[model samples]
Target chain A: MIERLKDLWAHRELLWNMTVKELKVKYKRSVLGFAWSFMTPLVMLLVFSIVFSILARGGDVQWYAVFLMSGLLPWLFFVNSLMQSVGSIVANPGLVKKVYFPREILPIAAVGANIFHFVLQMLVFFVFMLLIRWHFSPWLLLMPFILILQVVLTLGLALLVSAANVYLRDVQHFVEVALTALFWLSPIVYPVGLVASQFPKFMPLYLVNPMTNIVLLWEYAIYNPHHYGPQVAYISFWGILITVVFSIVTLVGGYYVFARIERGFAEQI
Target chain B: MEHAVEVREVSKMFKLYHENVRSLKEKVLFFRKRGYEEFWALRDIDLDVEKGETLGIIGANGSGKSTLLKCMTRIIYPTSGKIMTDGSIAALLELGAGFQPDLTGRENVYLNASILGFSRKEVDGKFDEIVAFAELERFIDNYVRNYSSGMYIRLGFAVAISVDPEILIVDEVLAVGDEAFQRKCLDKIDEFRDSGKTIIFVTHNVDVTREICDRVIMLEEGRIVRDGIPKEVVNHYHQVMETEEEASEQGNRKIEITEVRLLNDRGEETNDFYTGSSMKVRVCYEAREPIVDPVFGFSLDDYRGFTAFGTNTALKGLEMGTVAGDGVVEFDLKSLPMLEGRYLVSVAAHSRDEQTVYHWQDKLYQFEMKSDIDDVGLLYIPCEVKTGPQAG
Candidate 1:
């Protein structure tokens, strides 16, 4: 592990350049290139706000539009990173078969590119919140900490899927179906409180889902339902510990599986 | 002496899959079936390249030459054993292996340099030199997708060579681009040799290996068959390849070789000749059926399978039209300029274009030449020495 880390460090510039390449290629030859990054979340925000307003017929939650944006933006970051990274290795067989620096660079660069887009979208969304004169809790300072957790978790899963995709291409298609199911399972469209209250008997089982815990932390930090909606339990001490432990475990385990299988990658491809 | 690269008991095995089983359904369907054949690409290969030495690897196709190179470069791991290198390595397994099409040439230069583990600061120092070397100064700012194939390859070669790695592993990349660029790359490699860095090169171009390599290894199948000085190992390679080729004889048999003989100036059949002496090659053929416009030719080749001389009656404007029975054709040579060596002769009878071979005996006849003249080379040249002062 130390040797691998040293090699990764020595080739840090390569990692940086590859990440930049991914970001640049994603935006090239399009008139409204980088703008497309935020458009997905904003469009989803618009459609969901209107649709949920009609479905609830006067929901009691205050500043619900801002509430959805906070959870939805970070959700896009996690989801898009996984989607792009799953096929990263198989897409660039030229780099994998012909050159050797660190094989992990391919998937890591894909995640890195999504990270840039995610940050850009978040900055724009946060500035728009300030312009709306919306009040944010002091807990919003933990947004970066929550983001780091999400990144580690996403990168871990990304590494696992990308390496598995090289051996069994069905893994990429499988990831698409799995992400759709996972999206609804997470509290992106609704609050964790609704799930906790509706299925009070299974609330522990629901918290076991890492994203449920993670999205609740995002709500706790940026949404801060304690300030907006008094009935909601936005902050949970157990949720923070679970999110932190789950993120680290996934990262370490995902990277371990990825490294073990990568030796067969050139031949498999 | 310090070794730059050491490969110890390294062997690589690859599974040749009968059917690709990527999907879950296919994997389940083939779960009980044997799905692949095990093929060993390299076998217990042990070699150490001394620092500052230029080593050459030569082999036929599918002989694991490229596999060994990929192993040394860490592009693929060996199935057994390990390869350790003392210094940083830059491998040109394929020119422009990772150049992104959307990126500009300047961006790709730094990008490709980074892929080979060179720092941006290092690339910054040699960036202009790379563009100049590739002759892409005008297209450096343009996207690589728009560059011509030759231009793209040139830029790849330029960036790879400019890295100036401690241990350079090159595989057939020198054969790329036009002749002039090849010459320049070779010259630059020669300069690298002078600077005392290690180089491991794999190429089918034996002549170039003879010129540049301090040591050469020849691979056959998955094993190294010969390793020595370049000249000796290359000769062994020629011998191995020539002997591997089966001697074949196929023809319509309208006119087939019944007998062949080599005679001296006095018209006596012999298998020995002296340099500068007259000789005759006689081919006797029996025509089982009437054949028209038949040509016969013979080539004298050294033991290394290099053809030294060859000619045919078709080229000499001699045509045998509709021959019926046995006949003799004599190739009369006034003098032989061959130096001292054992030579083999291949005689053939065919149509005018030599396409429809009536019969071909590939290196089936042998002879020896003796030369007392003080000279060295494939041919014995007549000379007269003159001693003179520095006056006009």
Candidate 2:
């Protein structure tokens, strides 16, 4: 495993160049260029706010638009990276056949490019927060740590799906359906308090989802803590710890799966 | 000399699917003991290529030449045995393979160079040299999608050559681009060779193999048939092709070439002739039934399988109305203008209308031409030069 890391480290320049190629190629002819990255999450935030605000009318939700945007941006990053990286190996058959490099670079580069968009969307979100006159907290520094955890989790899933899709193309479609289902399963538009109040028995199971903790962490750092209540904040604190452990496990597991199947990639792709 | 590459009984097996099970549904639906046919693309082949030697591999399509190169380059793993290489290897298996059409030529150079395992600093140093070699300096900033196919291949080939690899594997990429660019690439390869790099070239052009290779190997049906000096191995490849073609020939049984002979001035059949001497090629044919106005033709090929001269009786205005039974056609030349080399004579009989070919024999008869005068080239043109300054 250390050897594989060293191999990948040795080819870090290739990974960087490929990531740039992805970013450049994605917005090559578009008039707005990379503004699309910031615009996509903003647009999703608008649609979700209009729908969810009407649904949660006369409810105890404050600044639901800001809450939805924060969660939706990260969710979009996760889904988009997986969708693009799943086909990264199969799409670049020419490179896979003609050249020799770490096969994992393809998927990792996809994740890297999407990470750029993720950071850009965050910057845009921060500006919108300032416009709304939101409170500032030193705890906002913890967002980078959460972002690192999210990156690790995203990389693990990207590696798994990208390598799996090479052997079984159905994995791509499977990921699409699974991501859609996972989107509603996690509380991106709705508050976790509603789920906790409605399904008291399943609250623990619901909090087990890493995204639950991720979204709660984002809301805690960006929004007022009283909105979440002390009890919800207590569970979210432990949820963050569980998520950290889960991220490490997934990352290691994903790396092994990727490495085991990478040898036959040249012939299979 | 130490061997640059050594292959020890290397073999590769590929699973040939009747239907590609690209999806899980098919794999489950057609669950069986054996889902695919096994194909051994490379047999247990052993080879040792010395450092600084230029080796050529020649074979018919699907004869495993490319498979062997892939194995040596580690693009594909062998099922059995082992292969060892002494230094960094770069292969031009397919040109411009990883190029993104939407990116500019300059961006693609960096992308492609890094993919070939060059560091960013290395590419920056050689970037100008690569563009100049490809002659794409003006269009470097333009998107590769706008470049012509020639420019794409030129850039691809240029980066591949500029990497300064210790061992280079070229597989027919030079067959693309214009003739001038091809010559330039070949010159670059020659320069690499002079720098003592090991080159393994796979090409169908025999003249290229003769010009560049120090040794050559002929592959047939996943096995090496001949491995020796380039001249001898190429000759063996031609002979094998001729025999295979003859084996597959099924004539219509109208007229069959019974015997073909090369005769000297003495009118005696001989396999040897002297340059600038009178020679005759006699072809005898037997007609199963009566035929009309059959055109008899013969083509002369030099040792490298290049057609030197060819003519048909019909083209020469010879009228043969009706022919039956056994017949003979003789083509006589005042002087054989070929240089010292082995040559092949191919004879064919066809209707004067040129629709129905009675029989066509390729490389049916072989002959040797000897030259006492020292000259280099395929043909010897008789000429005398008398030069004086300011003759006018």
Candidate 3:
């Protein structure tokens, strides 16, 4: 583990280059380019607001657009990274076969690119809040830590999927199906309180889902600043801990699997 | 003296999975996992090279040359055995494998060089030299996707040689660059050889192996068949090639080779020919029915299967016509331009469309280069060089 860390540290320049190159290629030749990053979340929030408001028919729920944006922001970053990283190895089979670096770099490139988009969308999120009557508080200082958690969690899953893709090309399809199921399972569209009222087991289920903690942390920081207290801190800490453990396990396993079959990749690919 | 590398009975086995499980049910049940068959790519390979020695590995395709190089570089773990090496190793296995096409050439230099273990400070010091070597100073800022194939190799090779590695492992990387670039790379390799770095060179060109290596190791299938001086190992490799060809002829495939010959101007069989010598090659076929077109191509390949000179009768607008019972067909070469080496002649018979292959033969006849000392490369291109200050 330490050796891998040392290698990553030694090759820090490569990581930076990979991230920058990823962002460039993604936005290149597009009509709107990076603006589309902010536009996507805004559009999704507007549609969800209109649909949810009609479905509720004048409920006690306040600021429906803000509520939906909180979940939409983190969900978009996580799901987009998960979907793209599944083919990270198979798509760049030439790079994998020819070079010997941390194979994790391939998946991490996607995560980094998605994180860039997520940050752009966050700027739009703040713009919407300023347009309304909400106040930006001291809790906004912790947004960077919350964003790091989302990155770690998403990258950990990306590593596992990219490695599994070498043996099972169907992991790409499996991830799409799995993400659809996970979308409703998480407290994205609705609050945990609403789900807990009917199914009392939703609290444990929510805590088990790493994104639940991540999304709630985002909500506390962005929408409900007063709610940022010891409970949110405790959840963020555990989210970070889980992310670290998961990322390390996947990184090591992926590296070993990659090195084991590294020779045959040239012949097979 | 300390040894630079030690390989004790190192072998690599690959488990080839032909039918990959695609569905969730099959993958969960592990149904298709049992179909994998294990094949040893390298077996009981043992050798050692002292510091500053250049060891060349020569073998046929699928003979484990690249596998052995990979194991030595620790790019791939061996299935069995162990390797002990000293110092930091840099392996230039594939050209531009570490490069990102979407990234600029300048960015790729730092990215790929750092991946190979050089620091930003180190690369910065040699940045100008590397660009000068590749002759891409103008395109440095442009993304690598815009670079041509030659430009890519030039930059890739430049980064590889610029790093002062203690041990450098190369595999056919020199085969792609242009003549000038290849000369520059060879000079750099020579500099590395002069320094005390252990170099393991892998190539299918026997002449390259003989020119650059202090020792040569020959591998057949997965076993080390011969190891010693380059000339001795190459002779053994040629002898084995002959035996293997004879063995394959007796196999289940029934399209047999009856006779092969090369004729002179008067149509008499001769073993000697010179550069620019107009020669006739006759190949006798013994099939019950006529083989149309038959491709009837022959290539003068060096001992390592690197083709030196090759052309087909169909390609030269000479149709072999039709042949029934037993027959002989001739290919008249207008000019044979090849230098000194033990070159093998390979022939193949395909359909008129050249899509479906009917029969193929390699190393059917071997010839020697009898050209002048000034001749070079796979083919001898006549040229005159006047030195002593270019007419100033």
Candidate 4:
């Protein structure tokens, strides 16, 4: 394991270059270029704002766009990285079979590219928060730590699915289906309060989802629910601890799985 | 001196699946029931490349040459044993493998250099030389998507070549590009040799090994059958290939040449000879019916079917009476004209009028020609080079 780490460390430049390639290739010919990164979250916030504010009439939550965008940005990063990385190895058989670099660089680069876009979307989100004059949460001090936890968790899952997708290609399509289901399970579009009040017995099981607490942390920090509507949103001290521990475990476990099966990747790809 | 690369007890086995169960759905359906035939591509092979020595690997297709190179480069792991390299290795298994079309040529050079295990610091210093070698100065900033395939390969090659390393692993990549560029790449390899870096080269072009490698190894059926001097091992490589081929015959047999043998000066039967050495060709004939004034002839042709030397009894003014039963006719070659390479022998028996051929086997016999001469072309010609400033 230490040897592999040293190998990966030596190829760190390749990791950065590949990540840059992914980012540049993603919007290569577009006139708008990286503006699309900020555009996506803004469009989603607009659509959701109209749907919830006018149609659903959820007046219980003030400035609901703030609540939705805070969770939505992180969710987009999670889903996009997973979707992209899951197919990274299979997509680049030329690299996997022909070149000599740490195989983990492919999926890790996928997550790295998403990290750039995630940061961009967060910038857009904060600008909108200032525009709305939304009250700030004291928990915002924990924002950097939450972002790191989310990255660790996302990187782990990305490596797992990408490596798995090489052997079983259906894992690629399965992730697509699973992500759609997982979106609603987590409090991305909906709030944890809605689930806790309606299915109180299952709330404990729901919090067991690492994404649930991770999303709740995002909402707690950015939405600043203490000043807004605690009735529709919730964050727990225990939930924060569970997610922190869960993310690390997932990251370590994901790295282990990736290494064990990486030998088969060239042949399988 | 120490070994630059060590491969000990290395073997690779591939599982050939009957039905590829790649999808998750199919994998679940076929769980623990996937049927595959096992093929071992490499078998307990051991090799050590000494520092600064250039070793050549030559083998027929499916002989595990590529598998061995892949194992050495860590592209694919061996099923058993280990490979250790003492220093950095730059392997050109392929050209332009990881180039993203969207990236500019300038960007891809850095990306490709890193992909081949060169540090950015190394690339930064040699970046200009790489671009110049690729001849892409003006077009370096253009997106690779617009570059021609030739430009793509050149840029890819230039990156790998510019990264000087302790070891270089080349797998037939020099066969690409135009002939001029091929010469440049070979010159680069020669420079690498002069710089005293260890190298492992694999190619189907066995002749290149004679020019470049310090030693040669021939592999067949996943095992090293010959490992020695370049000329001998390459000769063995030809022999292995020759064994896989049989002569095409088309003639009626009133009289047949039952067997053909090549003998050296001492009349010892063999299939190997050297340039300027006496060789004897014995054609063992069986006459089913008596044939008069029959012409017995043989042609020594190189592998390309270009006749190097040929003769006939009639042409040489030899008249034979009726031959019956079994007898041997001998042709003595005072001194072999062959330089190097496998030579095929064909023999025939025909009526004097040439209306009837008794039996003719085309390329039925072969002999390996070894020589000390280093001159090029069809056959070795003895000559002296008179040189220099005042010579006319």
Measured against the native two-chain assembly using Cα atoms, what DockQ does each of the candidate structures obtain, in the order listed? 0.71, 0.55, 0.23, 0.74
Model 2, range B297-327, lDDT digits (tens) per residue? Answer: 9998864567888999988999988888999
* CA displacement after TM-score superposition, residue B392 of candidate 3 (Å): 38
Q: Tell me how far the alpha carbon of residue B349 in candidate 2 is from the true structure, in angstroms, after superposition.
A: 15
Winner of 1 and 2 under TM-score: 1
lDDT of model number 1: 0.87
Cα interface RMSD of each candidate: 0.7, 1.1, 3.2, 1.0
For candidate 3, write residues A106-219 as lDDT tens digits: 778888888888888877777878888676567678788877766766766887777677667778888999899888876667665566567766566566666677777776
lDDT ranking from best candidate downward? 4, 1, 2, 3
lDDT of 4: 0.87
The prediction achieving the highest DockQ against the true structure is 4
Which pairs of residues have clashing backbones in candidate 4?
none
The docking quality of candidate 3, as DockQ, is 0.23
Residues B276-347 of candidate 3 have per-residue lDDT tens digits of 677777777665566555556777766666766678767788766665566666677877776655666776
Per-residue lDDT over A148-167 for candidate 1, one digit per residue giving the tens place of the 0 to 100 score: 99999999999999999998
Residue lDDT tens for model 1, B76-117: 999999899999899999899899899999999999999988
lDDT of residue A142 for candidate 2: 80
Best to worst by TM-score, what's the order? Answer: 4, 1, 2, 3
- Whichever of 1 and 3 has more lDDT, that candidate is 1
Give interface RMSD (Å), model 4: 1.0
